[model samples]
Target: MAGGAAPPSTARGGYRLSALNDDLLQEIITCLPVKEAARTVVLAKRWRYLWPSAPLFLNDADLPQPARDVVVPRVLAEHRGRFRSINLAYFRLASLDRELPGWPRLLADKRTQRLQLTNRNYLPPNQIGTLPHIPADILRCGSLQNLVLGFLKFPVDLSHGVEIFLPNLRELTLAMVIISGEDLEHLITACTALKTLKLTSLTPKRVHLRSRSLRCALVGLSRVEDFAVVDAPLLERLVLYLPGTGARVKIGYAANLLVLGHLDTRVHQLQIRDMVIKSGLKPNTMASTSTLIPSVKILAVTVNFGVLSELNTLASFLRCFPNIVTLHIESVLHDPSVSASAIEPSGEHHAKFWQEVGPVECLRSHVLEKMAIHEFRGDQDEFEFLKFVAMNAQGLQSLHVVLQEGDTSSSDDKKVNEAREKLQDLRFQTGISGVLLVLPKEGILSTLQKATDLTYNDPFRF
Candidate 1:
């Protein structure tokens, strides 16, 4: 049979062969260290061609002035047209004027796809003006895709607005940079293909962000989103940090709602599917309140509910999110009595007053489907108050009661144990899932394991 078999085909004609070869080449190139790739040029005539095709990655250590002066010129001379990508990072050139001319020229090559320039220190103020003109030769290049600039300080006269057009750019990250808001707006408008934009620790005097192509945005607390400026029809994720005053204040409005209103008509098609707002509180400044309710599916807020006045205000704000299916309330005033003195009961009798005015069922029915109360201290009064609301509200499917350990008074201990027993009884009688009592740390896990059956299966460890 072996002798009779027809001669094997000599041609390598198959899709599998091509795919395997491509994958093997990618794996081999990825496995090789940069040093090994650079050394390929000295291996032999056959290896010389491979080094030019290798990805060009230049970091501070690889491009020390002495090494750079020798290797850079050689790389540009030989691999100028063959380079697949160029990453120039943490480079400290001896002279801005001397380096600026060649740097942009090197980046302008149609072969360049990734260009990153990060300076360790601020560039000389006088040299800042020369940066924006970014050699017209480089700007005209159509191959660039990702551009990241760090520690860039532009001159005050720089009017290149936020709309700096880069037709092919997809991702842009500007860090520790100073630009005027107008220039920022110009840059946003110019980059029609920009998809992801991150601005951090930037001091833009008057910032305006009006982008038609931006899909994801990350802005600092100091800057507010001017939705009126954004024209992107497919924008999805937005993160903003609103500046906070030290004073404790109630959240009256949803920040997402306010930002969404400012967005242009084209932005209506742009869905803000996710939003996050973070703020710090001052000792006594009035708190920022928001009421803007956008069509968001997921929302998360972290705030200190130390002021009793803010609780109802927050509840009112939450009612606006009609589509919200999940709600989380953290570090809420578990023991409203801690500041009970501050809350003036409306009626003469305190007990009767709470029974009459407390909108417990209103809160349970209006916004919350399932509620999780974190850092909960088992005060019987608070538990009884929650139980009363749970009994009335039909929507509450699950309830998590976390018990935080602190300096427990004798009365407090008795009240906690009684609440645990009462909650257990309620779970058995009403068919409501028993309250989940959790310990805050791992050290107490074993101690709590022996203490109660209600200990959470995986206790939250802080």
Candidate 2:
């Protein structure tokens, strides 16, 4: 009797169909609004008991203090034993100046599979210790699969080494919580089945993590993925950010596992910084030259020119990612001539010394398919640099050059016309297609019109 509906009519009389199966009923319940799902009991005589089977979705924003008090008791009275998930967000209980006593008991229910509690507002002093009450109960629920707890001011203590005993837990997210290093280590060791773990605003400054089943980890700390702290065996995707000046951080991959197998299988995506590659190295000595992450097909690198003295180091590091088809550089200066004036003059021949360092050579035989230079400024050195690139980059299909306007001299205008003439000639010589020169927003039209006229050859053609 699926959906409590009657069977197809026979010629003789109406026949009652069997009740709906669990899977079909669950699907229908999921489609219904929380209020509608709860009210479905009044739809028909047979549906009176079916509303309890509907999955629970509690939005704290919609629940006023009176509404919560009214709904919580009614829900517990009707479907207390049937709830599978409870999502609580920004729930502030005003009725009870003290913590709600029944909240922990409800989470302890064996049927509860997922629990999410997030309080973004500042809590009163008395409510600071209320977080542990929920975790204390949830640890007993063997069916718990996902747990997320975020606190604004409540600091957590993991010094005693709290272990989530739920063996089926797969996802865990903790924010603004404090955990001791030893307790953090113990937690990772205990949660062998966890697949995703995210930690933010953690205390004690650092935590050591070693897990066999962890697949994804997002850490926001001053130092994350320190080789001495993390030793995850099956971790495939990691997003880490380190904040704070003058603090050194280092991360290492196992020598035997240079190519990340999980990434190759489409199960992992790695985001690593260029600074991480240069950390923990002597001035001239190179870091480990090889990585085991062969499965990585996409890489986004942010090269800090301030840290890298030579541009060749950036190129050499890119070469390591062999499978990289698309490379995105956040802020890269292809033409080194832009920073010429920034160098301080030292002696009588300082100008000559600076001139020699101006455009070394253009990227000739690079593996990239496209290159985008943001804030591009063109001069004689930059134009010559473009010509050098035109000679190389055989696979190059697209080129984007963005220029910033500042002070322009008459000599600069003459050099630009000459460069445009050379580019127009090269465009005809080489079959290379799709060349776009983007100028500054202020004087773009005039610049393009002038460049086009100088390079125009239609009038000379018969």
Candidate 3:
């Protein structure tokens, strides 16, 4: 061996990754799961000390159940760097009370940024009210940006004059959390910089929101009987993804609202400004602007066009958003098991209902640029609505018809071809040259990640 030659590298066959510099190695370790990241220490002598130098990311849900209790505390105590994110979603509230009294302090000390501390224990609807309250200290993380708390109770008492604030927090998600209206208001008002808020499966009877900085809000799978945007000047997107039936949703004073949708025509009672929308309500006349909401540029509605009353409800619903640039229609299939007397008989007059429903200002005024129909079963009623849009939406540049999955009668390709042909025929008659796209339903499900993303223009598109 020459005197100046470098010492034989430990880089062995198939272990070429070790040849990379320490910074790259640390980054690779940070991206791995906590378990796999920890195991990297045993890979080589050099790798043994690299884990603690990188930022920590711990998710208890990814660890084995038996090892979680031991591993979480041990890693939290041993880690010597800041925490990138922590998700303790697999632990019960009772376990946290007994085993981790200093957990919140540990997080703050480590400069933790994103935390998801969830109680995974199942609670029935009646028991939810009695669930354990969130630890006050957990809300004190000043460096926190994104927080997700689940299956806990929010403290209702603000009597002590103690304030709760997260100055840098941006995104917050409360999933299956029990919260009184007063505390809910306080919590939201405290996060002054907050941008995105999601309320999922909450039992709160009423949710009245008021935020100046909030942009995207989603209320889904909740039993909230009344939900309203009380005063949000900068709010843009209000999504009701799968709200329970009989919910009344009202939009008030949100002048910048750009995207809204999935308003179930059969179940939701919609009110904009001063007007309470109903099935029989007609489009705005030349003299009245009270019922119109012109700030909304994107609108989504769920309807069973098979039902005559719901079709009319949809017509009334669209009349409110007179300046909608994009329209998303979720076609709900009607049940055939109902008595024949309940079903509207299909006829020439029924097909002409869209034409007779007067004028939808958004379509007739050429503000609607893009239109998409989801869960399209190729039913006649669905085509009627598309035809109406095609003929009236003079500025519509793109039309997408997404077919429902599991249609056994024909292949997906065949369904797409048939839909394209029908759309072509409609275009031929209307002299519309807009691009038409027909897509299968596979891999197009909307995800929570997309729902919370403020940058994603249309969260409900997929």
Candidate 4:
């Protein structure tokens, strides 16, 4: 038969692919997504069963109930190998509730390492599809390393006798989910090996995280009133994006909290105890005894560019994190459509603030390796901020300034150019090895001839 004519399926593009061994065919199929890989069945007889037989990554989330009932079960039944993953983005929630009790059993048996049950159904604004009880057996999926469930609300309090057995769950992301404070803590505690936890838009009054193995956490845009790190010894990287919330973050108990990225604008108290920041006098926010940042070396903070004209707050902050080696200042550009706030003329203090001063009291003679300011519009605020950094940061090897967008005429270009000239013109140059001006969106606003001068020659030398 091979010597004569090929099968109808392999008569055209099929034969070339079928010529490869099973491993090669599977390698090719693995590169394609689940649906596309399944579509390969029509190519050749060898593939008809191969797609169903391979370690399944079935994504029949969009299929209708009638078709899914037949196709999903049929493929699942025929497949002999364990499933690699399953993504159920869209499905009949009511029907899944009525049936699909064995969903957990199937996932546990198939060894689903990653599962994403994201519901993208069209719904009203601010409305999330509540998830029914996750089959308790699913928690038994010890091999499941990553879990993503969006637009879901658990029926009951997970803390009330609910014991999670997912021992290997390393990363868990829950968005638009209704979980209470105690329940969230309980769920986090359940995942014995959980390292990274991200919660977005979750309505929890208080979230107490106490995990020995927790490393990184991102809590964003949530209605969390109080967030305390009860005990996360291994926690290194923590990001809080509480854009518009009155949430307070307390992290004095944590021993090794290093990198913190905070974006919340609310004047919530940030306490880091057992660490002396400023010795004598303190920033107004410092309620307790002043202690410098104990372990934090990298800090990323978001600031409204319009309000940065005064460097008093930033100066006070740098005093707290005196050992900050790499500082990322992300400027939140205000919409010009929004009416600009009327600025009162500078006061007597303003004259003193603007005058060429010695190194900032906090940054004076300190080894600030690099200062990166995003959205560096050369306005009164940014100009003053840049002058303060350039004059204060003694060991500043590189000054990386990312200019903000401007009136389509490349004000990014204009601002970058002007700022560069101003920095060079500044009489104060302590550790000023180089002055760089760049566009935040674009990399740099320099010429082909002088781009090297703006780029960092040795960022890691320190």
lDDT leader: 3
| TM-scores of the models, in the order given | 0.58, 0.59, 0.86, 0.78
**Per-candidate RMSD, Å:** 11.3, 12.7, 3.9, 7.0
Candidate 1 residue-wise lDDT, 1-462, digit = tens: 476654334234433323344335444553454556677567555555654565555443455556654565455555533344555454444443353446555555535677666665456755654343233344444567887776665544445421133689887777666676766676767778987776665655344566667765555434333322234455544443333211111122223321111111111111122222222112122212232244443333332344333333333334334444344444433233335564432233322322443333224444445555555555443454365445554565666666665534555877677757766766322256647564543353353232222132221222
- Candidate 2 lDDT for residue 342: 45
Write one digit per residue (lDDT tens) for candidate 4, span 1-462.
878887776787555667778877876776676658878989877787676656777776546646765566566555776778777776544545445546667788888898877666635545544344455566678789998877766647677765577999998888777678888888888898988887777877787888989887777645777777878998876767655445666675666776766533223345555432221132233422354555776676665534423233444455556666677776555434545553323334443553533334335546566667765555556556566666566666666666544522553566566667876776546645345544325432232112112133222111
Model 1 per-residue lDDT at 31:
44
Number of colliding residue pairs in each model = 39, 11, 0, 7
List residue ranges in candidate 1 displaced over 4 A: 1-27, 30-33, 61-77, 81-85, 93-100, 122-141, 154-163, 222-232, 242-294, 328-462
TM-score of predicted structure 2: 0.59
lDDT of 4: 0.62
Over 297-339, each residue of candidate 2 has an lDDT whose tens digit, in order, gives 3344433333223222343344345443343333334235436
Model 1 — TM-score against the truth?
0.58
> Against the unseen true structure, what C-alpha lDDT does each candidate score?
0.46, 0.47, 0.78, 0.62
Residue 8 in model 1: lDDT? 39
Clashing pairs in 4: 275-291, 275-292, 276-291, 276-292, 277-291, 277-292, 309-381
* Worst ten in a row by lDDT for model 1: 260-269
TM-score, candidate number 4: 0.78
User: Judged by lDDT relative to the true structure, which candidate is superior, 1 or 2?
Assistant: 2
Q: Model 3: which residue pairs collide?
A: none
**Worst 10-residue lDDT window, candidate 3:** 279-288
